[model samples]
Target: MATISEQNASSISPVIRLHRSDDVVIARSQLVGGTVLQEEGVTVSGLVPPGHKIAVRAIGQGQPVRRYGQIIGFASRPIAPGEHVHTHNLAMGEFQRDYAFCADAKPTRVADGNATFDGIVRPDGRVATRNYIGILTSVNCSATVARAIADRFRRDIHPEALGAYPNIDGVVALTHGVGCAVDAEGEALEILQRTLGGYVVHPNFAAVLVIGLGCETNQIARLVEKQHLEALVSTGRLSTYNIQETGGTVKSIERGVELVQGLLAKANDARREPVPASHLVVGLQCGGSDGYSGISANPALGAAVDLLVAHGGTAILSETPEIYGAEHLLTRRALNAQVAEKLVARIRWWEDYCARNHASLDNNPSAGNKAGGLTTILEKSLGAVAKGGTTNLVDVYEYAQPVHAKGFVFMDTPGYDPISATGQVAGGANLICFTTGRGSAYGCAPTPSLKIATNEALWQRQQDDMDLNCGPILAGTKTIEEVGAELFQLMLQVASGQRSRSEIHGYGQNEFVPWQIGAIT
Candidate 1:
C-alpha cells in the first residue's frame, strides 16, 4: 500500500503489493482530470489514470520493479518515490525463460462430495449443462438447408405433426469459413473437423445431425476417420446427409427435417440428475468496457471466478487486447515458467502481428470506453485482467483452438465479443460469463451465457439482460466473495438448463462469427 497522510484515507494505494522493491501502486478508484492525491509521502506532482500505476518508492538505475510478486519490468533511470509510472519510465524487455516439463496439476480434491448440480447425464461419461438437438452444417452450401430444416421442425410454429419431440430447443445451424477453400488435408481444415467433432460429443447436446454438401472439401467421412467420430454414428446418436448426394436444397431440407425429428425423440428421453461441479467450464469475457469496469464489475466477476476454481471447476479468460498492459500480473501466478512463457510469447506475437498489419493494440479503448472514463489501453487492460481471478494460469491456447488447461487458461483472441465468444465455444467452453460496465445485452450460441453488470445502476437499467449484479461492490454492500459464491450457484442452474433472459429472447443462433485469421483471397 502506498503511504498517505492521515487526513486522507482515500489517497491510499489501490492494490496489496507483495514486494518491497515495488515502485508503483494500483489506483483503487478512478483518478480523472485535475484530481490530485498524495502517495508514498510525496507531494502531488502528476495525475495517474485509474488502473494505471503511480510510483510508490524510489528505484536506482538497472533495478527490478515488482508487481504481483514478480518482475513486471525494470527501471529506465533513477526515480524518486511517489512519481507517476507510465510508458516513459517503463518498457517491455526480453529475458531468458525456462520452459521445463509441465505435467498434470494437482488441485486438492474437493471434500464436498455432495456439491453436485442437477444435470442431464449422457452415456458418454460426460454431463450435460443443457439439452438441445443441434443441426450442424458441414459446408456453407448446406447452411440454408440446415436453417430450413430448423424452421420446419420448430415446435412453436409446427406443433401440428411433431408429436414425439417434447420441449425441444429449436435447431441451431453451426456454419463457418474454410470448408471449401482450404486443402483437404490442411491443418486449418483438420482443426475445423475436430471442433465440429467435439460439438457432436458435447454433453449439452442431446442429439446431432450433420448436414453437408458432398462436393465440399470437409466431408463427414474425414470427421469419422480423423476424429474417431464413429461412436456418434454407431450409437444412433448422429446422422449425416449431404445436399449434393440428396438432390437439391428442397429435397435436402425435407430429408434433414425427417432425420432431426428422429434424433429429437432420442434426446427427449434424458432427465436431469446430480452431477459434479468440475464438469462446468465458465468462459469469462468482457466487451465494450469502460473505466467503471475494473473498479466494479470485473473484480466482482473475478471473485466469482475464484469460487468456481476453489470448487474444482474451470474458468477461462480471453480477449488478448483487453489484457495488454496487465499480462504481467497473470505471468507471476503461472504455476510454472512454461505457462508464463507461453503467455508472453503470445503477447510478443500480437505485438509483431499488429505492427505487420499496421494496427496498434492501444487503438482499442473505443468511444464507449473513453466516454466511460477509460483513457488508455494500459488503464483498460489493468481492469480487464480482473476477470481471470487469482488462480495460476495453467495453460494458454491460440484462437478457436481447444483449451487444454484446467482451472484458469488464457486463449489468444481479438477483443470482439461475438468472435471471441465463438473461439471460446469452439475451444470447448460450455458456459460464457461476461461482465460489462456500459451494459452490453450480449449472448452466445447454443452454449449458455450469463451476463453480469459491474454496477447497480447498469443492473437496474438493463434488468432484462443481466443475470447477476456485482454492483454491491460499488455500493459497498456485498463483498466480492459473497457475490462470487452466488455466481457459482447460478452457473449450476444454467448448466442444469435454466434459461437466461437473452436465451429466452433467442440470443444464441446468430452469434456465431468464426475468427477469420490469415489472408482471404
Candidate 2:
C-alpha cells in the first residue's frame, strides 16, 4: 500500500492512484473521451465524471478489481484500459478473506499531555459537552405525550418558557417507533430497553423523564431495573410515568410538564468546567459518500481519530454492514485475539442476518451513494474503514451497548445513519463527526454533530450545513494531517459550547431512530 505522503503527491495529478497496484485511477474532474493521460499512456475512451473511476489497465472477465491495493470486486466482462469501472461492469463475487488476527497490531504512541475542553461535569464524575433535559418514550404510544412535555419548554414556541433558566440547553424528546408487539423475552425488547436506558442516564442530560404506555411490552419499570437505573430514580435524577397510570393522555402530558418544570432549577444549576479531552467520545460517521471520501474527509478524520486516541480520548467506528469487505483491516489492529474475534463474530452474525432476510450484505451503496460514485459495498467498505485511523482496535460491542473501553473501539450497527448514530450515542458518544460527499443533512440531540465535506464543490454548494472542508486535501493545497489538526482543534471548540451547523439549523429531534429487530407479533 502507498503511504499518505505518496498519495498526497498523486492528489495533485489529474487522476488519483491510491496505490500503485490499483487497477483504476479516480478522475479528479470530468474528462471527455479521447483525452490523453500522458503519464499512464492511456486515452480516455469515454467521459468520466469527477470522483468516478477510470480503468488504467485491461482486466479480463471474472478477474478481481483492485482499489486502495485491495480487492473491491470482480469484473463482469472484459474491461479495456481507460474505460469506466462501475456497477455495470463490476459485480460481487465470492472471495476468501484471511483474518490474520493481531498481525498488524502496534502499541499506540501516547501524547505528552492531555488536551482540555470546557465541559459540564456531573455529580457522578461523567463529563458532558451539552446540558439538556431529555424526555424519552418507552413505547411509540407515548411519543406524543413525551413530545408535548418537551414542547412546553421550547424557547422557539414560547420564548419566555425557559427565560429564567439560561444554563439548560433546550428540553428534547427522543421517541422511537417500537415497544409493543415484541416478545418480552426477545432480543428486540432487550435492545429497546438498553437504548432507552442509555439515554436516561446520558451525561449530556442533566435530568431525564421517561414516559410510557402502561400496557406496552416495554414496561418503564422493567427497563429501569434491567438497566440498573433504580439508583438514578431514587435520587430524582430520573423520572418515569405512564399514560394509563396517570389517568390518560391529557393528564399524562400535564403531569409530565409539571415534573419537568420542577426539575428545571436543579438542571440549570449544572455548570461547565475545564475537563480533559478523554471525556470526549466522538461517534465517527460517513454518509452520502463519493470516491473522494477516502482520499479527503475520511482519511483526514482518521488522522484526527489517531490524535484523539494519543490524547487518551475515545472514538467509535461503527456501521458493521458498511465495513463487510474491509473487516480484516481492523482485525489486524485488534488489541488481542479476543477483541479481534469479537468483531469477526459480529461480521458473521451480520452475514447470517442478511441471509435469513434474503438480502445481500452488498445491498449497500444506496442510490445516492452510487450517484456519488461508490461502486460496490467492497469498494465502499475500504473507504469507510479509513475513518478509524491507525489505532489498535480496543473493543467490540453490540448495537446500543454502552462502551466502557477507551481508545479506538467498534460497535455493531446498521449502515442507516440515524439508527447507527443512535447506537453510538447510546454507547456514550457526546459528539459526532460526520463526513459527506453528496451532502447529508443530519444531527443528534444532546450531542452536537459536526459535518465535514469531502470536496470543495459540496462545501461551497452547502456551506450552511458544513462545519469544515477537507476538500483542500483533494485540491492539493493541504495534507491529511494538516486538515486533521484543524479538525481536532475545531472539535475542542465545539465541545466547549460552540454550536455546530446542524445544531444551529435544528436538525436533531427527528433523527432519533433506534434499531428495531425481532418478530412484530
Candidate 3:
C-alpha cells in the first residue's frame, strides 16, 4: 500500500492522498456536500464517511482504481471527481503480479541496538518473558479436568501454597476444541502433534502437564514419542496422565493438581535476567483492519519490525490467506531462491485449496472489513504486508513449527485471527503485536499481546483494550519512525515484566483456537 506524505500539506486537510499516481484520497474526517478540499481544488459532491475514499480525478468504467500506488480494484461504473469510491463503484478483478524472485533482496546490515530486557532464563539456555505452569489437554474430552485442576490454584484455593515461590505467573489450561474426531494420520494430525510439541517445549511454560482421554485417536503416548518428550519427563519438566487411566475426571483433576503443585515450586524458582534483543520473537498480526491500517498502525508496526530485525531479533508474519495478493512483495525480499520458492509453494497450495473448496481468494474482506473501507483481498493484503517492514525473508515454516532462524520469517496459518495467532505462539513467539481499526479484542497466554489502535477514535473508544495508538501518524502529530520507536521501547518494557492491556484484563485464556484441518470423521 502507498505511504501517504503529509509533509507539505496543511494540518487541516480534509483528505489524504497516498501517492501522486493514486486516483483517490481517503477522507480524513466526515465530509458534507460542498466542502472544499484545498489540496485537490475539488468540492465534495456528496457525503463521505471518514476513512472512505473520494475520487480525485474522473475514472472511466472498467478502469483501475489505484491506491497505495497499486490497483485496489477496477471501477465497475464511471466515477466522477468527489464521488465516494467503494464497493458500489469498485469490483474485484485479476491482475498479474511480477514475482521477480530475489530482485529486491539485500544483505541485512545488522544494527547494534544496545537493547536488553529482563527475561527468564531456562535450563536449556533459552530466554522467556513469562514463567507459567500449563495444563495442555490433548482432546476436548479431557478439557474439563485440565481446567478444573488449573482453576483451583487460579482462584487461590490454597493461597499460601505458592507463597514460597513468587515468580510463577499462574496455572493455565490450554484447552482446544479439537484433538479428537479427526484422522489419526496425515497433515491434520501432523499439525496437531507439532502444535502440542511446540507448547510442551515452549520456554514460557516452565513445566507442562499433558492431559488426555484414554481412547482418542490422538494418543498421548504416540504424541510424546513422536515429539521426543522423554527427556522432558525425565527432567520433571513434563508430566502426562490419561483421564480413564487415572480413574476418570475427579481423580484426574486431583492427580493433576498434585502434579502441578510440584511443578509450581520449580517454576517459581525461575528468574528474569538481562537478555539481548536477539532473544525476542515477535508475532505480527492484524485484525478488524480499516483504511488506516496501512496508513498508520501497520506501517508503524513495520517500522518497529525493521528496528527489531536490525537488533537481531525475530519477527513472524503469518496468515497466508491474508497475504495472498501481496506475496510477490515478500518474495522479492526472500533471502534466497529457496526461501522465495517455499513461500510461492504455500501460495499455490492455498489457491488449489480454495478451488477444491469451491471458493476464491477474493472471498475475504469480511463484513467489518468492507465497512471499514477495505474492498478486496488485494487491497487488504497490500495493507497487511506492511506489518513485515522491509526486511529479508529468512525462512518459512509450517504451522506450529519451531522458529530457529532470526530476522523476518513466515509461518503458514489461516486468516482467522485466533487460529493464526495460536500457530504463532506455538511456533515460539514470546510476544505478539496485534493491530486493529474496527477493534478486535484478542490475547494469548504465556506470550503477552500488545493491542495497537489504528486511529485516535478507536484508541479512545477501546481505552481498556488498546495498548498503543498509531493514530498520530495519520493525524500528523507524529511520524511513523517516532511511533515505531515508541512501540519498540514499549516492547522491551513489556518484555521486562510490564503487563500489557490484554494481560492486565486476562484476555488470553479463551483465545487459544488451534487451526483444525482435514475431515472430522
Candidate 4:
C-alpha cells in the first residue's frame, strides 16, 4: 500500500510514475512551464505533453531511463529534473534480457467451478458465442462471387424474416486478397491453408460455403486434402465450388446463395445454453497505444485475462513484433521448458523475417504512438505485453493455428493489429478485447470486440465507439483489480449477445488482412 503522501501525489500531482524505481513520471495532463511538483520537489522546466514522461530526478548522460521498473531507453544526453523525456533525448540501446525460462510458472488459484456463460452449443459439443452462415473464398478470383452471394442475403433478409431463424447471426463473406499470385507450396501456402481451414471449422459459423477459382494455384481440392477438410465435406456442413467448374461468375454466385440458404435453417437451429466459461477464448489486442496504456487499461485488461484463465478459459496474447522487447516476461511464465522454447523460437524467426525485409523490430511505435508519448519500441512493448495479465503460459501457436490448450498462450503474428486480430479470430478466439489510448475505430467480423479506453478523456471524446472506460484507474478512483472485475462481468455480457459499440457502428466489414509472406510470383 502507498503512504498518504504517495496517494495524494497520485491523486493531485501533475505527473504519474508507474514504479518507485522509475526515473520518469508521466504527465497526467499538459504541463506548462512554472508548474510545481510539490511531491517530488521539482518544477516544470518546459511544456510537457499529456502521456509524455518528465524527469522527476536529476540524471546524467548515457544512463538508462526506467519506466515500469524496466529500462525503456538510455538518455542521449544529460537530463535535468522536470525536463521532458522523449525521442529528442532518449534512445534505444542494446541490453541483455534475462530469459529465465519458466522461472515464474506457478499453480493458478482456480476460480469456482461453476462460472458459466450462455453459449450456442453445437451438436458436436463445441460452444460458440455467435452463430453465422459464412461464404469463404479460396482465391481472390472468387472474392467477387463470394461477396455477391453474401450481399444478396444481406439485402434480401429483413430483421422480421431473420426473427424466424432467431439463432442465426448473419451471413458474412470472409474474403481475402492473396489466395493466388504466390507460390503453390512452402511455408507461406501452408499458413494460408491453415488459416482458411481454421475458419471453416470454427464453431461460430454453423455452416460455410467455400468458393474457389479452378485454375488458381490455391486449388480447392489441394487445400481440402492438405488441410484435412474432408471431415466437413462428409458432414455436409461445408460445401465448395469452383468458378470455372460452375461455369463462371453468375452460376457460382447462384450456387453459393442456394448453399447458404440451405444452411440458414440448420444454423438457426442452435440455441444458447449454459456452458462453462472454459469455452471462452478471448484474443487480447492493444492499438494506438500511449504511455498510459500499460498504466491503466492494459493492466486492467490483464486482470480480466487472469480472471478468465482462473475460470478455465483461454486468452491469446499476440502481436509478436510489438512484444519484441518483452518476450522474456512471457518466457518466464511458460508452464514448461518446451512452451518457453517455442516462444523463443518464434522471436528468432521474427528477427530473421525482419532482417530479410531490411527492416527492424524497432520500426514500430508509429507516428500516433509517438504523439501519445511513446518513444521507443521497448517502451511500447512493455506496455503492450501487460494485456496478457499474469497467467502461466500454457502454449505457443503458429499464426492461425487452432488453440487447443486453455489458460494463457502466445500466437506468432505481426505487430499490425488487424492482421494479428485476424489470426487470433481464425484460430478460434470467439471474443476480442482491444485497448486503445489514441482511439482506433476497428473491429472484427464474426467476433465481438470490446474497445477499452485507456483514459477518461478519450472515452468521453469517443463515447460512441468506446465500450468501457478504464480512466478511473488513472484517476486513482479504482484499482486495477476492481476495474478488471468490472471488465470480466462486461465480457460475459458481450459474449451473451450484447452488441458492442463497434458492432453498432458497423466498423468491422473490411479489416481482415492476412499476413502475406514469401515472394509474389
TM-score of each: 0.80, 0.98, 0.98, 0.97
| Candidate achieving higher lDDT, 2 or 3 | 2
lDDT of 3 by residue, 27-94 (tens): 87788989888788778899888888899899999999888888889999999998988889999888
Q: What does candidate 2's lDDT look like per residue over 1-521, in tens digits? A: 34344665654478877898999988888889998887788888888889999899999999999999999999999999999888889988889888899998998989887789999999989999999999999999999999998898898898798999999888999998999999999999999888888888889999999999899999988999999999999999999989998999999999999999999999899888888888999999999999888888999999999999999999999999999999999999999999999999999999999999999999988987887788999999999999999999999999989998889999999999999999999999999999999998999998999999999999999999999998888878888899998999999999999999999998888899999987898
Model 4 lDDT tens row, 195-312? 8888888888898888998888888889889888898999989899899889999988888878877877878778888888889999999999997898889999999999999999
Compared with the true structure, the alpha-carbon lDDT of candidate 2 equals: 0.91
* Segments of candidate 4 deviating more than 4 angstroms: 1-9, 155-163
Best by lDDT: 2
How do these models rank on lDDT, best leading?
2, 3, 4, 1
Q: Model-by-model lDDT, in order?
A: 0.71, 0.91, 0.89, 0.87
What value does the lDDT take at residue 169 in candidate 3?
A: 78
lDDT assessment of candidate 3: 0.89
Instruction: Write the number of the candidate with greater TM-score, choosing between 3 and 4.
Output: 3
Q: How many times do residue backbones clash in model 3?
A: 1
Which residue pairs show collisions in model 2?
Answer: none
Error of 1 at 467 (Å): 0.8
How many backbone clashes does every candidate have?
Answer: 2, 0, 1, 0
Off by over 4 Å in 2: 1-4, 10-12
lDDT of 1 by residue, 140-230 (tens): 7888888888777665677654556555555677766557777676656765776677677676777788888998877888776777778
